[model samples]
Target: MKVLEKQARTVDEAVQLALEELGVSRDEVEVEVIDEGNKGILSFLSKPTKVKVTVKPKPEEVAVGFLNGLLHFIDKNAKVKCLPEDEILKLEIESEDAGILIGKRGSTLDALQYLTSLVVNKNCEEFVRIVLDAENYREKREDTLEHLALKIADKVKETKKSIMLEPMYPNERRIIHTTLQKDRKIVTKSVGKEPYRRVIISLK
Candidate 1:
């Protein structure tokens, strides 16, 4: 949050000055009239209106700032672009070392997205969903998960034994579940607690 004080001939003028200086819209800030100016007797003595304005940084700005600092801390150079689509903010990171940022199974990227969302919606009145991706990692990961699900389902059918996959996040588990939902030969069920929960594939 940033605070600024400005004075003009009227309260509205003072507020406008503060808004211009802060580079934010009226709804993004809080304005308080510090002193309502008075035209003294006979107009000999006059006072300028004063206002105090407090501005909150927009969500996109916050997301960019956070990603920049994070990349710097990791000693990695990446280009981050923030795109606002309706109520969702899509953050795309492009870099030659995208693999490093993505980490194994995109766990690092997921962590970064989670932290970014927390920072962006910290003081917001309405929460916005943040979607973060690096070099199309999400789509690739989804494809890999769907393929693995089918492979595992085939193994389950042959061995007549239930196979429990490695633990995965809910989103990944959902991909597996949805991919095999229509298969009449096998069934998928999620088991265990989060961060350790996995999908169980068994022959029908």
Candidate 2:
């Protein structure tokens, strides 16, 4: 965030000047009226109005900064590319050693994304959702999940018995549920508590 103090004939004027210097609109800044100047004795100006202005951090900027800082600890060459969408901030981490950050089952990537989102929304009026990906892991994982769902559907139909899948993140579970949602012969339900929640596929 960039902060500045400006003095002018009035609070509004001071804030306007600050905004002009900062090259940002009023909505993008937090304005604090430090002093409402007053007219002194004999029609003399006592003190000019003073205001403190600070630019609000945009969600993308915050995400990039936060993820880059974390990436530095893991890999110096790692870089985060932010692609902003209407409702989500998409962060793509590119690194020669991306697999390290992705970790087992993308645990590390998800952890970093969670932290980045927390930091991004800490001051936001409307929460901004973040979609973090590394080496297109999310799409790849979705494809894998879809394939698993199809295979499980076949197994369930052949055995006439339900199969409970391994624990999955909410997103992964969503893939399972959505992948089989349209199938007439298969049904999917989430069971167990979080961090161990599983999808149970059964014959419809």
Candidate 3:
């Protein structure tokens, strides 16, 4: 949260100054009148009114708050931890049944991550990427995909036939393409449109 203190002849004026500096609306901030100046004798020794204004918390703070409410609504006994690095927010879910959160092939986790990104970036000036994981599921899934890609490439080399894998999201397809890029006997390409797009491994 960003905080600022300002002083003017009136509390409203001080608040206005704070709002302009923070570049936020009145409803988006908390304002406290530190001192309502008194009109001294002849107004010659009067002090200016002072106020302290605080802007709303950062995106990470907002995201954590939202996740807490969401977890409670789902009745899931889990804890969310956020780590911000550069332009990406890494969120991890800790729970005894973490696999349930990951869902089949990490579809559920991807959906949750998308929603969280929307919530965090709504009305934000600069968008930040959100990466969600549960019990290191993302890393494990990447490793699995890389292994599958190599295995498929070997099969393609031996049979001299192209094999089209099941439909996958773009990120998953990228993993397959990247994993086989350096193989001399095989190549990879993505086929079809979104939601049904898949990777095809074939002999070079």
Candidate 4:
């Protein structure tokens, strides 16, 4: 993508010149005026206009570039080999005794993945959906969540009431809600505040 600007007698003329220079149609470029031309008493004596023109990339290219950067960063800094799948990216990191990356209950790894996603989205000219995981961590996490949901749902059935599960991030909560969506005897709902919010399972 490239941006170009120039001053001309009128906004329309300025945009036209930009399109000509960019070798693109008028619809392909975005034009914004930094300074509108001042029209004098005589039409021929109008002040020059200043406008900015930008060219954008196609959505697919943007998504590829974003994933490329993510792969590079993981390989260079984390010393991990990452491969981009059709809809997700996978990483392999050697197991360490300290397990610093996993943090407390894999919080650090989760935070790293989130930050990587932010960087990819920031650099791309178009929106791209990226999912990062280490050694199928997301799949394992999903299974764990399903088990927990079933356990809580059983408790709810036995007690004939609701059971409040500990707070989780939006993604984790979604997993819980989705995993139990088909169960006719149990229902899931979110409660409390963000960062401290939790999921409640009740008998349906």
Candidate 5:
């Protein structure tokens, strides 16, 4: 669970403002109005009340939770110890046989990661992005993706021809789009169908 705090002149305003900033709705948050500004008499000016708001993490957990669960299962089923680390609700699991959780092509691992993040973020009233990783796989993949984005951007610039990149997951595609979007001489666009879709980088 995450705790997000904010202040506003009124309870409604505090909630509304927090909701906007947190990307959450009224139902997602439990609000506490800590203070109302002071109102002074005659010679003094009235000050708007200050409010303190704390937002708690939602109950919903994501796919990563399932991976963590699976890790537990493996530990119990195979007698391997699964250690868990919760960094601000971002769960990282370390086990003796972490490879089993990773699975082939990291598919099982990805599924678990995806679910855990989904559940945690959905239930989290605050904008807490839950990241679950086992054996540093996600970190390595992220590094690779970052390098690939840079490589592709360089290629697009060198060739001076619109380059079509391999289809990628939404996150990967986002990385590509973000990496090249700032280039003054080029523009990026996503084309093709889902699963087989790809991004196009063209000279603008």
Candidate 6:
């Protein structure tokens, strides 16, 4: 949300000035006429109109602002780019210090994503899914997970023994489960609780 107060000769003029300053259309903002100018005698004695203009809440903008501040706070000269669509907002972090933001196995990235999602959804009428990624980290990690699933499936079949993978986040487990679902000869199941949940691959 962004707000500006402007004083002009009329309410409409004040609103127009505010809109121009905010860089948004009239319909995109909520305007409140604080004081309608009074032409006491002639235009020389008139009082100026005052109004407050607020840009409606926009989730993508809020997310970008929050992420940029957070990045700067962490002493990183990163850039935030937004790709917005219906029900989803994707933010990409570009910087030379990508490794720090990504953290081990993308834990830092995931944490930042969670915090950003919370900020974006605050006071919003609808929930929007947020995805934060650095250097296409999510896609690269997904590819790696898919490959791991296939390799482990092959190993399980070759050794004729069930294999339990290290605990993985829910989405990671989902990738493993979905990738192996087509293999009728191989079965995948997730066991244990979240943050410690492990995926099991064995003979069906």
Best by TM-score: 2
Give stretches of model 4 more than 4 Å off.
Answer: 1-78, 90-92, 95-98
TM-score (all chains, Cα) for each model: 0.80, 0.94, 0.77, 0.59, 0.53, 0.77
Candidate 3 backbone clash number: 0
Candidate 2 local lDDT, residue 5: 100
lDDT of 3 by residue, 77-111 (tens): 88899988887889888888877778899998898
Clashing pairs in 2: none
Give the per-residue lDDT of model 6 (tens digit) for 13-116.
Answer: 89999989889998788888888879689868989999999998788888999999999987468999998776679999998889999999899999999999
RMSD per model, one decimal: 3.2, 1.4, 5.6, 6.4, 11.6, 4.3
Q: Per-residue lDDT tens digits of candidate 4, residues 41-98?
A: 9977878999999976543344445544654544433445456567555554433322
As for candidate 6, its clashing pairs are none
Clashes of 6: 0
Tens-place lDDT per residue, model 5, 47-101, is: 5544544455433344344554665656643222233345445556666776777
Error of 4 at 111 (Å): 1.2
Clashing pairs in 3: none
Model 2 C-alpha lDDT per residue in residues 30-149, reported as the tens digit of each score: 998888888676556477889999999888998898888888888999988989888888999999988999999999989998898889989999989999999999999999999999
Full-model lDDT for every candidate:
0.91, 0.92, 0.87, 0.73, 0.64, 0.92
**Comparing 3 and 4 by lDDT, which wins?**
3
Estimate the overall C-alpha local distance difference test score of candidate 3.
0.87
Error of 6 at 181 (Å): 0.9
Comparing 2 and 5 on lDDT, the stronger one: 2
lDDT of 6: 0.92
Which segments of model 1 are wrong by more than 4 Å?
Answer: 1-25, 32-49
